[model samples]
Target: METSQALLIYNMASVEKCPETLTAVNASSKQLNCSIDTYGNNQYMCLPNAEKSSLVEFCYNGIMGIQVEGNCLEAKDGRVILHSCKKFLSGCPKKPFFNYDFYKYPACQHINLKHFCYESDPSCQALENSGGFNNVSNDNRDIMYGLIGGLLVLVILTIVIAGFINERRWKRWWWSFTGVGNEPDRKPDKTSGTTTNPGL
Candidate 1:
């Protein structure tokens, strides 16, 4: 009889200092309504005091999936619940958990972690053998920059060539307009009118 080997799975462990929630957006005006530039992606608007200065910082990785641990979330009324996911944040949870509607529910059920599980923002499985498009995106950006640089160099060369041609044309035009000793190979033409001015 053939038997199947069980798959090994690991739970990711993370340390959360503060159980603060977050809202996300760009623009300083909106950030003021939300919070500070923590992620710097300008993706998340923050909630006031939602983040702890020391312990709230979390580093999650794709290797083991994810898990979160932080101070118990305390509601304004003083009820506490385990703060594991983004729901406990001052802002909306963007993931497996909640949204702005969560705030509408009574505080009695606000602290639930069942909704959040570590997930690939884009299905990681789709990019599995595709050379990690996220990583490749950076290389593509570099290639674009190089192409732009090459184009700029070409433009400068074209401008320089055009200017050189224009300079020669201008010199020819100036000689034709003013009739200055422009003939390098011909001698001056003279007529005998006893003193006829050749310039006339």
Candidate 2:
């Protein structure tokens, strides 16, 4: 699965076409650093007008979503382009770097500004196969570690149980580290009607 792709309608909210959608894009005025390509199903998904005459379109069954994130790059010309980054969109509204009213237009909250969704492309599967944005992010890596760590817990517990069984059979002197048999049971002497301990 692509690490990330153009969002589908389900992934986002309130769908509409913005011919002036370029207002939502931020190219950093720098050259596009990354050049990864994804294909929609039979047809392509959205192509970057900015990326020469490369015609990228979507081909997933119906219009699911898109992966490349862009906004109204051509919004100024009243023509819309979906190739903006809005890299700063996460910590929006609550702590906006540049204040813009997002409540009225939540999509306006896109820090990459140029963020938009599109129809699903079956051919886009090619892009999906090529891999997504980058190696698993640090947060995702942490989650992976956690899942692995959790699974390892079961292994640890199984080892512990096995150790207990072995300890019972062998009576090892070094089996105390796990605190498995820390307490010794006290038995009452019927004749003396008194209690005595073994470790003492």
Candidate 3:
């Protein structure tokens, strides 16, 4: 069986695990030092695209229906600081951050945007319970494989049955042709008390 691949988790537990500095705006713009640690095993399922020139963090909080909290990033005293975090729908019709969306993963279906928090958060204690996109994908793949395997088995069975029937016919033909220890199709006529062609 093929092993299933796990989804990537962006753990911001420590500075080493997280990006030390990200471009505040664009690659050409000033770099911002990251310090937005919730200190509760900051595990992020999805993150904003760093390639964009804007400095914004997308946090999912389920206050309304699947809200995405947009926290503006600012450089203060040579360090990056979260200016303000606001709530928006998961769809983020305004497109809060540059290409920041959370509905991309199927696992997001089970996770409430508002309940999303640091690993230490009580609401996130059951984070593992939330199914992942890979899990769903793997399930679908397994079902497809099962159906294909069943079809193959059925085809093989049909072929084997056909071969068996053909083999029986072949054996009968061979026995008749070779006449090996088998009676001939024609027998002597008893009424004439002599061996003669049965057809005659």
Candidate 4:
């Protein structure tokens, strides 16, 4: 997909993740910064590490009917930290402490981790391999230039033809008005043997 298309998908997914409440603060190649304030004091920012995480999560959850977690939530080095997920979780116990700071990898480990997605995400790879994003084919460019050139030539030809027709019309009108070539030929009268005005 093209960058604009991918960004559109990403934005759509971000909206769907929160549905009319998400706001994108900044979007760049390195990260997508977004925030949600609908949940009162529970306001939070969703920054996915990979460029296509929003698109991937949207496809996975909305289209594939699979539950995708840790997409918009925060993480460190592609691993979802406990504190980050806890903010969104409700009625969860806090007494039982775990040694590990990050949650265990999900079954779809490849998709859940941001680093893995960045490196080997199928959608992004397909988009890149298809030469659709940020890449233009030479043939398409050449065709565009050819069409422009043809149109320019057509315009010039039409102007030239119009000018030629106008020039001919002007010459005919000037000749008629000035009597430059419409004067009757004078001839000597044989009987009189001299040229003479009939009126005189």
Each prediction's TM-score versus the true structure:
0.28, 0.26, 0.27, 0.32
Q: What tens digits encode model 2's per-residue C-alpha lDDT throughout 1-200?
A: 11322322111112232211323222210122212223322211222223222222222223323323333221111122343334323321222221111122233322221222211222333444455545578899899899999999999999999998876655434434554543234456578976566657
Off by over 4 Å in 1: 1-137, 181-200
Whole-model alpha-carbon lDDT for candidate 4: 0.35
CA lDDT scores, all candidates in order: 0.32, 0.33, 0.36, 0.35
**23-140 in candidate 3: lDDT tens per residue?**
3222211122222224332212223222212222322221111222344322222222332223323322233432122323212222233344323323454553565554467779
Candidate number of the best TM-score: 4
At residue 88, candidate 3 shows an lDDT of 22
Of 2 and 4, the candidate ahead on TM-score is: 4
TM-score of the candidate numbered 2?
0.26
Could you arrange the candidates by TM-score from highest to lowest? 4, 1, 3, 2
lDDT of 4 at 103: 22
User: Which of the two, 1 or 4, has more lDDT?
Assistant: 4
What lDDT tens digits, residue by residue, belong to model 4 across residues 36-118? 22332112223333432442222101111111233222233433222222332232223442211112222112232323343
Measured on C-alpha atoms, candidate 1 has an lDDT of 0.32
Q: Which ten residues in a row have the lowest lDDT in candidate 1?
A: 43-52
Error of 1 at 1 (Å): 58
